[model samples]
Target: MLEARDMTLTELADQVGITIANLSILKNGRAKAIRFTTLTKLCEVLSCQPGDLLTFDPD
Candidate 1:
């Protein structure tokens, strides 16, 4: 979504009020958890729904 919006990670980090390292963790799918506030901010900035950003499938 960032790329689609022509946004850099740094820009997104700033917009989302997080450090680059934290954003990288989320971007890399290495994060074990995400705050609702953060998720809301990401959805707002990325112009996407949670379903567009994350997938759930029980194994």
Candidate 2:
């Protein structure tokens, strides 16, 4: 989605008030959880729904 939006990690990190490393962790799907506030900010900035940012894979 970031690539599709032409947004860089650094740019998003700054916009989201998070460190690049933390954002990278979420971006890489290595994050065990995400704060609702952070998720809200991401959705606002990315102009997307939460569903767009998350996937449910039962594997």
Candidate 3:
């Protein structure tokens, strides 16, 4: 998704109003939580729905 947007991590972070380090944590899947406000910003900036950014794979 990140690559598909042609956006660097830094660029997305800026657009999403988050720090690069925080975005890195989310990208690496180490984030224990996410605020709805932040999630909304991410979805908006990424031009994607929440479902597109997240998946439920019970594997």
Candidate 4:
């Protein structure tokens, strides 16, 4: 989505009010959890739905 939007991680981090490193963790699928507020912010900045940012994977 970031690539599709032509948005860099730095720009997303700044716009979403999160640290770049933290955003990177989320981007790389290393985040253990996410706050609802943070998710809302990311959805807002990315102009996407929650489902668009998440996927269901059977482990």
Best by TM-score: 4
Cα-based TM-score, every candidate: 0.90, 0.91, 0.87, 0.91
Instruction: State the lDDT of candidate 3 residue by residue for 1-59, as single tens digits.
Output: 89998989999998888999999998887787889998999998988888887766555
lDDT of 1 by residue, 1-59 (tens): 88899999999999999999999998888788899999999999999998877765454
* Cα lDDT over the full model 1: 0.91
Q: What RMSD does model 3 have?
A: 1.6
Clashes of each: 0, 0, 0, 0
Candidate 1 positional error at 50, Å: 0.8
List per-prediction Cα lDDT, in the order shown. Answer: 0.91, 0.93, 0.88, 0.93
lDDT of 2: 0.93
Q: Residue 35 CA error for candidate 1 (Å)?
A: 0.2
What's model 2's TM-score? 0.91
Runs of candidate 1 with Cα error greater than 4 angstroms are 57-59
Count steric clashes of candidate 2. Answer: 0
Q: Pairs clashing in candidate 4?
A: none
lDDT of 4 at 1: 93
1-59: candidate 2 lDDT, tens digit per residue? 89988999999999999999999899888888999999999999999999999877666
The better-scoring model by TM-score among 3 and 4 is: 4
Query: Mind giving the per-residue lDDT tens digits that candidate 4 earns over 2-54?
Result: 99999999999999999999999999888888999999999999999999987
What TM-score does prediction 4 earn?
A: 0.91
